[model samples]
Target: MNRNYLLNDAIISPLGFTTSENLTSIRNSETALKLHRNSRYFKEGYYAGLIDLDWINSKFSRIGNPGKYTKLEKLIILAIKQVIDPSQNFSTRSSGLVLSTTKGNIDLLNNNDFSADRIYLWKMAQVIADFFELKQKPVVVSNACISGALAIKTANDFIESGRFKNAVVAGGDLVSDFVLSGFQSFQAISSKPCRPFSNDREGVSLGEAAAAIFIDQEQSAVGESVHYIDAVTANDANHISGPSRTGEGLYQSISRLFNNSGVDPSKVDYISAHGTATNFNDEMESISFNRAELNYVPVNSFKGYYGHTLGASALLETILTKKCLLNNELLASHNFTESGVSVNLNIIREHKRKELRTALKTASGFGGCNLAMLLQKQSL
Candidate 1:
C-alpha cells in the first residue's frame, strides 16, 4: 500500500481566505465570530462567523466568472484553486475529487427561482469536478459533520488501493435559514460565541467555511515532516440528533485507531476535539477521552473561534492543526474558563511552544458517528 500525505491545503473562512492568513489570525487569538443582529435566519440576533459574499465574489471574479457560481460553489472552487500549483504536472486520469458537506445548495431551495436540480449533492460534486477537469467521477460524502474527515479517509483509501494517485478533498458549508432554523428548533444555537468546555457555556454558534486538502502518495509532492498516520470511523447509532450517553462510538474509534496503529494515547501531544459547546456533545467527548485514557493530553476546541461550521469543521480544524504542528505552537481553546464536563481535561488556555510530533483529531456528529485521525510529523 502507498503512503498518504497531506500535500497542500487552503481555507476560506471569515478569519481570512488563505491558510497563512488564517494561521496568523489564529496565532494572535483573533476570532471572526461576531454577533449578527440582522441575521436572515432568526428574528433574534445570533452569533456566527459568516463569510462576506462580496469579498468572495470580488476574489472569485478575478479567476472565474462570478455571475455563474453559487455561494458554496465559489468557496469550494477558490479553496481548491489556491492549493494546486500551476507548475506541478499530474495525470488527471489518476486524480479525483472528493466533495464533503452536510448540506449542498440546500439554501438554494430557499429562493423562489432556485432550481430543484441544483439541490442534489451529486450535482454539486459534479460542478466542482468539472471545474477542476478531474478525469474520474467525483465522490460525495455527506455523513453528517464527520463528512470532511471521512472524505480524507476515503481519499487515502483510493490512493492506497491504486484507484488514484492523488485526491483533492474539499469540504464546505454555509449557515442559512434552513440550517439555522433547524438548529434553533433544537435550541442548539448559542446567543453568543460558543465557549466549549466552559461551565456556563450556552450552545453552538453557526459558522460558514470552505477548506480543501491535496493528498498524494508522492513524498516529494508534499513537504517534509507531515503525513497522515491513520483515520478510523465508528458509529453507535444511538440517536439521530444526539450522541451516545456512554460515548461508545468515540471511545471505540479512538481505541481502534491506537490499537491498529500500535500508538499509545499518551504519545499524542495535542488533541483537536469536537467540542461543540453543547451539553451532550461536550459531555460525551469528556467521557470518550477519559475512557480512552487521553485525559492527560492537552486538548482544545476551535468552536469558540469559528463556531460550528458543520461539515467543514473537521477539515478546517485539521488544516489549522497542521499549521500548529509546523510552527510548534498550540492554539488556545478560546472562551474556556472553567471545566464544564464531568471529567478533567488539560484544556489549552494560551498559545504556548511545544514540540508536537504526533496529534489526534476527533469528531462526533449526529447519528452517533465518530471519527479519529492520527497525524505525525515525519523526518526528511
Candidate 2:
C-alpha cells in the first residue's frame, strides 16, 4: 500500500479563522458556543457555534467575487484557498476534490429568495471544483456525521489506488433553522455547552465550521507530517436516529483499523472520540472502547470546544488531533465533571505533556454509522 500524508490544512470556525488561531483558542479552553436568544433557528435561545455571515462576506470579497456562491460554498472555497499554495506544481488532472456535508444548502429550500433547484449536492460540488479548477470529477460524501472522516479515507484510497497523486478534502456544515428545528424536535440539542460523558449531560450542541485538508502520496514539504495508516467504516443499522446498544459497528470498525495496520493497542497514545455528550452516544462509545481494550488510553472530546459541528466535526477534529500530536500534549475533555457511563475511560482532565507516537480518531453518527482511523507521527 502506498503511504499517504497530510500535506497542509486550514480551518474556518468561530474559535478563529485560521488553523493556528483555532488551536490556540482550544488550548486556552475557550469555547465558541454562545447564547443566541433571537436566533431564528429555534423558538427559545439556543447555544451554538456560528460563523458571522457578515464577517465571512467581508473576508470572501477580498479573495473572490460574492453573490455567486452560497454561504456554504464560500466557506468551502475560503478554507481550501487558505492552505493551497499556488507555487506547488501539482497537476489539476492528477488532483481531485472531495466534499462532506450532511445538509448541503437544505436551508435554501425554505427560502423564497433562493431557488430550490440549485440545492443539489452535486451542483454545489461542481461550484467548488470549478472555483479550485480541479479537472477530476468531484466526490461528495454525506453519510451522516461520519461524512468528514470518510471523506479523508476516500481521498487516501484514491491516492493509494494510483487514481490521483493528491486530493483536497473539505468538510463543513452550517447551522440553520432547518437543522436546528430537526434536532430540537428530537430533543437532542443541549441547553448548555455539552459535557461528554458527564453524569448531568443533556445532549449535543450543534456548531458550524469549514475545514480543508490536503493529502498526497508524495513526501510532504512540511517537515514530519502525520501519515494515514488505515481507516475502517461500519454500520449497525440499529436505528435511523440511534446507535447499536452493543456498539457492534464501532467495535468492528476499531478492530478492523488495528488489524489492517498491525499496530498494537498499547501503542495508541490518545483517542479523539465522537463524544457528542448525548446519553446514548457517549455510552455507546464507552462500550466500544472497552470492547477494544482501549479504555486505558487517554481520551477527550472536542465537542465541548466547538459544539458538534455535524459533518465538519470529524475533519476539523482530525486537523486538531494532528496539532495535538505535534505538541505532544493531551487536551482535557472539557466540561466533564464526573463519570456518567458504565465503562470506565481515562478521560484527560487537564492539558498534559506526553510523547505521542500513535493516535486513533473515531466517530459514530446517525444511521448507525461508525468510522475509525489510525494516525501515526512520521518517524524522524
User: What does candidate 1's lDDT look like per residue over 1-380, in tens digits?
Assistant: 34577767899999899988988888788887887876566777889899999999999999888877789999999999987764153456778788899998888886754456778999988888788787899899999989888998899988888777788889999998888889999999887789999998999988999999888776653445578888899997799899998999999999999998888888999999999999999999999999999998999999888999998999999888887888788999989989999999999999999999899999999877999999887767
Model 1 RMSD, rounded to 1 decimal: 1.5
Clashes of each: 0, 0
RMSD of each: 1.5, 1.4
TM-score per candidate? 0.97, 0.97
Candidate 2's residue-wise lDDT over 1-380, tens digit each? 76688768899999999999998898899998888886665667888899999999999998788777889998989998886774273567778888999998877886755556658988888888898788899999999999999999999998878677788899889898888889989999998888999999999998999999888776556567688888999998688789998999999999998898899888999999999999999999999999999999999999998999888999999998988887898999989999999999999998899999799999999888999999888855
Clashing pairs in 1: none
